[model samples]
Target chain A: MSFTRPDGRGNEDKRPLHIIYERLDRVDGSARFGFGDTKALASVSGPIEVRLAAEQPSKATFDVTVRPLSSLPGTESKALATSLRGLLSPSLILSRNPRTLLQLVVQSLTPSPIESYPPSLAAACINASSLALLNAGSIPMTGVVCAAGVALFRSTTEEDIPALVLDPSESESREAVGCGCFAFLFRTEIAGSQPLPTNDTPGARLVWTNWHVKDGTSDDGELARAQALGLAGAETIWRAIKQSVPQMDNLPPPPLPSRSTAGELGIITQSDEVSDQDMNDAKIEI
Target chain B: MALQTQTGTSTDLNAQIFQRLHPRAYLERFIKEDIRPDGREATEWRDLSVHVGSISTANGSALVRLGDTTVICGVKAEIAEPDLERPKEGFLVPNIDLPALCGPRFKPGPPSEEAQVLSDRLASTITAAGVLPLSALCIHPERAVWVLYVDATCINYDGNVFDAALIAMVAALKNTTLPTATFNEETGRTMCSRKLRKPLPLECLPVSYTFGVFDGTTVLADPAAFEEPLLDTSISIVLDEGGALLSAGQLGIADKDTMSMCVSAAKERLETYGREIYAFLE
Candidate 1:
């Protein structure tokens, strides 16, 4: 049994990713990242005077705030901010500036449905924050953190098997039995020196993962498989980030290729070893 | 001091000092004994109580107590214009306030991040569970409708404000009575008859259960203020009256088995605690 995606993309296909660096003025650094329709604008202002109560002697105080598109920032935004702070903290060397503050603000650019989880928004926020941090160039970072979202769906006929879809759209998410966001850190400076883990690679170090499952009967192995798919999707996003870093200095950031040409542009490449059909299998059967 | 000197035991420490220094370790010692510092079992919940219609001024009101935690919820109804898209539907706005008087951690100011998050969670949960039918609140289409402002105030913050606030909000809504209303076409206003009133129509009752995981195991039900911060992960499950899951959320890392365990435990709670709550309201 096979499941068809609402956006007509394959099970492993991701939405067209768009990134615009330094989109705002007056801020130290800013970036607008979009996963198809879902978008997030993130800005970084760091190493500033720390608040008296939040000051730390050994490391800088890292703060993250998230604002929703239309409504006042609420628990959803606060939860997102906390997740972002935890995911991005490992990549930053906060010890460089002691007793200072590094503040990052993320603003949502799309109307989120009240019912389903916002995995795409989370992925976009993490990616935009990473870009903003890199664009600022003031804070030392261990690596660039890239993220991807994957959702699991099971047909009524084949209740035992659930298919994993990468970068699910809003409508698709409404039908998801479970969904997760996965992030991986990649050191850009030493890209080719070592055989850097690509989409098909098995050993990409995970930075952070969040999973929300609706059905309690779902298998645990499905979560691991969804994460593996997210890792591959994140690698695709990392390649796009690598392409955009070199073009940051130029005015009018380069426009990303459309979804059709993404594969040809090497932004979304599929490995020959693992095919989409193989991933659709219900069980590993090992 | 004299007792310590006489005992001459280096490991001996004051109870308060031990709790203040290594809070996690202090809690872990209790968990190892299969009990909490407050003398509750691992899966045991705090005592819960509910009261309704205490505030005569508001349309409806309820006060709920879960152990030392306390929350009071009041519902106010006002006539307002409806949205263009949904002319027949009214509005249900729910907000939770955690003031400085509740606990020392909160300062007197605008709503803190925690409070805002709690309010948002409450609002979303109520909406997602379809607890009330908005169209039922409409006195007339498009021109005038009853806008319900459901406000929950925390009088004391021991922990698990989510569960207490939600219970209070649901009970208050259930207790609400709306006066008979008439929309006059010529006057362009809605008038209410104070004598004739009807109960707000509630579709279902949704109850939430929150659990905190200690040391990657030992799920603690309804953790107190002292146990909340030290736990690594917290999971919340919302179930309707029919034992159907409305929503499930996890803050930190937890495996699939843990999540399933929490859900099953929540269902069991819904059977016993949920019935007790409804029975009190009746």
Candidate 2:
């Protein structure tokens, strides 16, 4: 039950995906992401002293969890957690903060036989974790953006697949067997570098691509199509992550400094509603 | 807020905070002038801007800004067994939270009374408005139902938090367009499909209007924190689109006459404020 494509995309192609980042004041760092059909929410806490016996010395410990959206964990989540641990642990710069723990919990939202797999969800989870770390004032990789899944769906009964499908729903995933995930990192970069100078470039174009399946079916046409869809997914995730990240940065300024009077913190009650003028007029000391 | 909690809930503490913050006299004057010092007529309201699909993670979400106030509302819906009592309906739970970081008064802990009160009010309003078509959420009546969690957060509190929160919440609900869920009669398993059905079953649009009473005589529409002082009482009116009132209440010291004044003030504001916001939403 495999779908074949000449160049993964035909005409009017799109990569379906959703990304969300919410602050969990309960945890040090947290974010939730849904790529194409796969969804995950990740929380990162600590840089504090490592607490577990399995903690690594001279470095920080990285913990990963993949909680599926629809069902309990199986082979998929474990594989995702293992793969994510490998990809993210090295990027943590753990030596900078030794004997600490960096926990990452990835909660996958979409669960089914056909939807985006855990691999792509893990990549997005890592990206979200990185962003959460940045929100927590922890500097990880240069920057982060979510990743999405792109699949080439062709009915087994027919030779020609439908138009290039972006992010397919669970039903779409079930119809197609050939699917993969793309990881995108969003960092604005100058067009030209010393080694890859942009002599042909006029203005700057911030490239947006991070990771994709390194090896698979070797058909040239199918490979091109998959790459193109991956690029499109990268662009889509970049736009969404870009929009969400700004709000995280635009936090309101800390509340006005307050002073305690009568050597005690005043108990505020319903009757304690103070006028704006009083908030300004009252003379108190912290 | 923490300060208030630290002090006992004795009438003295309540009186002190109320005296310092919400003075009855100030609100009375604003009501009397039929205008707020901020240059708004008694019926005028602050401008509003709403942006939807702002939060990527949530299934449906929106960010609404009214004057200096900002509220973020997100919807996360999940499938679960239906309640034994009401098997034919889905759930739409609305929760409002004000982070301590938003203001000095907000405390860090469980939701405050203000948050709980606002959530309950919004939840009831939404239910009455028929924002969620219960049948759409019903899966075989007593079998399964979709539980929607609507979380509204006040990131910034300028004034009239309730009005702003309501706007954001309804806007977010309006902005949300969900895909259809196909229930296979044979397998009995539900699958989400891209073929979107109709928008969430919405019956009517309801928004809340707040009136601040200062000086025991003045009726101030949408009072800011500064004018909150010298306020004698406050009123919040919930109305439908046809200029009909659904629910109205006063939140402080106000006589029956003052209450009538507050209602009239709220009605007038709804005529203008309602149209502008409703236009943005529709």
Candidate 3:
């Protein structure tokens, strides 16, 4: 007997995804991302003055604040914000603006049920923050980050394996035996050139993950398969994001660090010397 | 260069300067030697000690010390109305406090983000892992339920507070005993019998093991305060007595293989340290 999803979607199918850039005018970058009913609005303000205590000499301090709808920001929101900071930091090149602050605020547009696990809300927050960072254009980033939520549902038949569903709806999540949110970093440029279409590309680096099973042990291969499915879902979202933002292609490339400047800053090491030599060769060829 | 010139003569002074100025590089040098600055192996856990029923005022209390990190948890039971939707279920509210006395980094004020995050993680772990069944706390459906407020405070902060705070909370919960509560429907109140007490019906003892990834290669188990900030990626695994994975959380960038390695290591650690820490309760 085949396992059926509550919403009648295929096991691998995700809810409708929506991405809107520049949702707010005041912030440097802003975006609103939604997975069906679950939606999050993220705004980015960065390269701003750093608080005295949070200032880091070598890198920018990143701060994330998550506000839940119809309620004050609580421990749950703070936990989400902490995870968001860690998930989004890998794609951001914060070293470009040292001793400064980059702040990202995420507000949930829809209220999630109190008892349900919030994998969809988490995924939406991450995707919205990624898009907001891209829209800001101030913070240099190595790649675009995307996330997907996967839920494990028990099979109706006794002999069958649990069904893994992507982008689970609120009600679906409530019935899930286990769920996880996985975020991946997709590098847009390879050696200063845009790579081929990423649809067939493998190995998007895993940046963040949070998995929890309500009861009973999961099967050995269940988590690995869920992660793979999450990767596929995130890739689909990445493709959608790429298609929606034509201006992303026209954004100025990140500035290359010159050898002299790096040496003056006392950050250059033996490994950097090789890159410096390659830069000099390229300059001579030009 | 100026710092080196000032402390050139004394190697001790130079070492201190290196630790203060380039903490990450200093830690990397020690990590390359396959040893932490505190003389532990890459996967070595610090000394852990657990003591339960320490406080008499609270219904249940436990003190857990992992290395220099010390966390004390107290379980306070109170009578409250059950939510309308889940009339048969109780509430387990876990809050962690990192006061200014614990460390210099934490200030005395409202709950900081770190404290809130830890509290949230603990609450979710207890709920999702099914450590205790909420239905057991229901004295009368939709009328009154026993609410267990598991509050953990870090008296000394050395690092890996999540593990310490969780261990403390679980231990405290295990030591908790709720009074026999009876609802007086006429008075519309719940009365508790102080003499007759019953322990919480905990289904499983879910133990959590946290590992930090250094230089994206080496995994440090039970990272200390000094090591926590420098490491970017951390993986936490929660396992029950039967070695079943209850919950797992990872922050920052780490590959799947590393995560699996941490899980396997967590299982092995559960057999060794995890058992020893909870042995006192039995």
Top candidate, metric DockQ: 3
Q: What is the Cα root-mean-square deviation between model 3 and the actual structure?
A: 10.8
| RMSD in Å for all candidates | 8.9, 28.3, 10.8
For residues A1-286, write the lDDT of model 1, one tens digit per residue.
3888876889998777877664355778877687887888889998899999999999999999988878677577786787688678768999999999999999888888543237878888899999999888889998888888888887888666778899988777667876767777665555466664433332345655665555434243565677679888988787787766755654333554454454443332212224323423311421
* Better candidate number, 2 or 3, judged by lDDT: 3
Tens digits of per-residue lDDT for model 3, A1-286: 2778767888887777766564354789887788877888899998899999999999999999988877687678878888888888889999999999999999888886553338988999999999899889899998888999998887655776777899988777777888889999887445545557534543578888888887757355666778899999998888667654653332432332344433222221213345447535533542
Write the residue-wise lDDT of candidate 3 on B1-282 in tens digits: 664465566656667778888898789889988999999999899999999999999999999999999999999999899999899999988888999999999988888878878878888888888889999989999999988899889999999998998889989999999888899999998888979998887898888899999888899999999999999899998888777888888888888788788888998888776777766786
**Weakest 10 consecutive residues of candidate 3 chain A by summed lDDT:** A262-271
Looking at model 1 chain A, report the run of 10 residues with the lowest lDDT sum. A267-276
lDDT tens string, model 2, B152-213?
99888887888888877877777776667766778977777767644576655667778775
For model 1, the stretches where C-alpha displacement exceeds 4 angstroms are A1-6, A10-13, A19-32, A57-59, A68-79, A86-98, A110-119, A130-197, A200-286, B1-12, B279-282
lDDT of 2 at A273: 27
**Top candidate when judged by TM-score against the true structure:** 3
Task: Report the poorest 10 consecutive residues by lDDT, candidate 1 chain B.
Answer: B1-10
Reference-based TM-score of each model: 0.76, 0.44, 0.88
lDDT of 1 by residue, B96-208 (tens): 99999999989999998788778877887787567888999888898999999999999999999999999999999999999999999999988899799999888877778
Candidate rank order under TM-score: 3, 1, 2
Say what the interface RMSD of candidate 1 is: 5.5
